[model samples]
Target: MDNNKRKLTEKELKRKNDFEKISSEMQQKGYKIKNMTINIQQANFLGPLSMLPFITLTFLFYHNVNGFDLGEISLGFVVAAILFIPLAILHELIHGVTWGFFAKNHFHSIEFGFIWSSFSPYCTCSEPLEKWQYLLGTAMPTLVLGGGTAVVSVMTNQLLLFILAEYMILSGGGDFLIILKSMLYRTDKQESVYCDHPYECGFVVFEK
Candidate 1:
């Protein structure tokens, strides 16, 4: 997905104002801060767009291997639609739980809420994290619920599981965007810290 892709329309420009309140301590500690947060448009557009290949690959694999049943696919779609809300909530929780585990205050540093305007729920971690820790938390939900279920679906030949995997993977579009940006970002400095943006779909980085 990396080699020939175009740059994202949303750039992580100097968004210091967004971090002033949350990053007071990091400021005191001499961390050079930068925002990696994405806008609503990027979250709504780029996130899912990045995940298209994964979704297509999964569907094509299943279709090629097992050949979907029309009735089964219809039932799976119905069930996925009915359960999406709770599952979406779970997706955010997985981020919280995984990040919280490595946070200095544990889960106390985590917050969850919904953006009524955007129809999106968020999980935020107030503490700064090691780079790898941030990556793990960011990727956990899609790995477990999305990829794991796809494997099980293949083994069981259950179209419902595959459909559920597709929907969950789709929900991770924003997450995939965040992770991809985080990886592509470069620096000569050897150390960095990551903190989830308190109110946005992306995060901020603190570096020396």
Candidate 2:
């Protein structure tokens, strides 16, 4: 979809105006403001591609010690399919809850809903935040649920847990992209801000 061609709602306009005020101040301080966002549908299509290296290297690591078993792999996928719906819901809530903690208005600033285009639920935070704060929130689901489970799976040698971890990690493909973008972003002015876009999977960022 052509995101730029869509008209902004009144709320979005107000939000843009509010941020522009902050941008105005940064401009006065000799800093420039840039906006960033992502397309959910496009990102969804790229999800598996984004996860290629992690999944490849992981299986490669397991290949040295464990022989492949079709039955086990199939079971793992069945489990993943069963858990998909609940886990997907948990993923967005994870974003909302984590970001809510750092939001000025707390949970009031967080909104959740499903996206028919991406076939995924989205959690957005209206409140702006410091870079670390937003990054931490963005990383929590993949960290706590994805990385955390991956660790447990390796420690216990559980195929089910490994499957769950893999699913969770794959689910964060877009999160991984946004986090990388946010971290690589630079500013000479020593101030950076991030806010979840009102509806998109990614956030808007400013470096000042």
Each candidate: what lDDT? 0.82, 0.75
Error of 1 at 41 (Å): 1.1
Give the range of the ten consecutive residues with the poorest summed lDDT in model 2: 59-68
Listing every candidate in turn, what is its Cα RMSD in Å to the true structure after a full C-alpha superposition? 6.9, 3.4
How well does candidate 1 score on lDDT at residue 26? 76
User: Per-residue lDDT of 1-208 in model 2, one digit per residue for the tens?
Assistant: 1238667656656656665665667578765556667665677778657877777665665555454567888999998999898998998899889889988899988877775644767777777788888989988998988888877777666767777888888888898888877777666766667877654457776565
Top model by lDDT, which number? 1
Model 1, 53-85: lDDT tens per residue? Answer: 999999998888888899998999999999978
Model 2 TM-score relative to the real fold: 0.81
Residue pairs in candidate 1 whose N, alpha carbon or C atoms collide under 3 angstroms: none
TM-score of each: 0.87, 0.81
- Model 1: how far residue 185 lies from native, Å: 0.6
Off by over 4 Å in 1: 1-22
Candidate 1 lDDT at 120 equals 62
